[model samples]
Target: MRKTKKKNKIYFPDPKFNDSLVTRFVNHLMKNGKKNIAYKIFYNAMKKIDLIKEKEDKTALEIWKEGLKNVMPHVEVRSRRMGGSNIQVPIPISSNSKITKAMKLLISCAFIRNEKTMSNKLAFEIWDAFKEQGEAVKRKENIHKMAEANKAFSHFRF
Candidate 1:
């Protein structure tokens, strides 16, 4: 297994959006391998967005993409052992990992939100993220703050 690198599995685009990012989000939202349920939740959230969207022109998919973009973190802290003490090293996240992290954060924030259903909660989170005012966005800002605080550890890049 160590002889070669793991190959990336191809992700088919979601039928509704015809977009691979949507498929990726659905994958992260799936639990117990319930892909049907995950797809249902995402589709329902899109419907909610259509109903309550502020702008008259932008589509739900566009808003969702904006939300996802707003949630991405550029820099994050990693713990590094320096001598007997551990230091928090601020490192830049790679492009692929950043997208994955953004999707996961959006899903997690939606789960904790109070709403009648997962779809409704996800819709609310999406709208909040679109406006850059949700927990996911806050998490990203906090990561930047921590990274700034650990600026001295920039030399510890691995």
Candidate 2:
């Protein structure tokens, strides 16, 4: 390999929660190189979630984490070419990138909602994820389904 594999940089935790996962999620949410806007959207969504949800058993942050867990995909299908034919090969997902994938799905599904503000949409999606039902969770389920359907090609995995 050229110059060995690039080292993984460590990310400092987010200010409010002191959690690196939050920082990673914010990084995924960032656009136009504006990380502050992403943080604002995330924190505001937590606040909105607090106001919208009646139960006080779980904190907003915990609920968000739960939502991310629900949306985490376990397996996926990757395209591979063999014998002059392309196939969808199912494979188990790597643990390290799982959180990033979940974060990306959460942000994308939040954006698809018809809510007035991104915060509200994110809050709703987070709440739905906590309940194990949401676009993001549906997306995870779809990924698993696709992987299962493509299991026949799993041997094609390199």
lDDT of each: 0.94, 0.90
In model 1, residue pairs whose N, Cα or C atoms come closer than 3 Å (at least 3 residues apart or on different chains), thus clashing, are: none
Candidate 1: clashing residue pairs, number: 0
TM-score quality measure for candidate 2: 0.93
Off by over 4 Å in 2: 1-3
Residues 6-109, candidate 1, lDDT per residue (tens digit)? 57768999998899989999999999999999999999999999999865589999999999999999999999999999999999998888999999999999
Native-to-model Cα distance after best TM-score fit, residue 126 in candidate 2, in Å: 0.9
- Candidate 1: segments with Cα more than 4 A from true spot: 1-6
Worst 10 residues of 1 by lDDT: 1-10
Displacement of residue 6 (Cα, Å) in model 2 is: 4.2
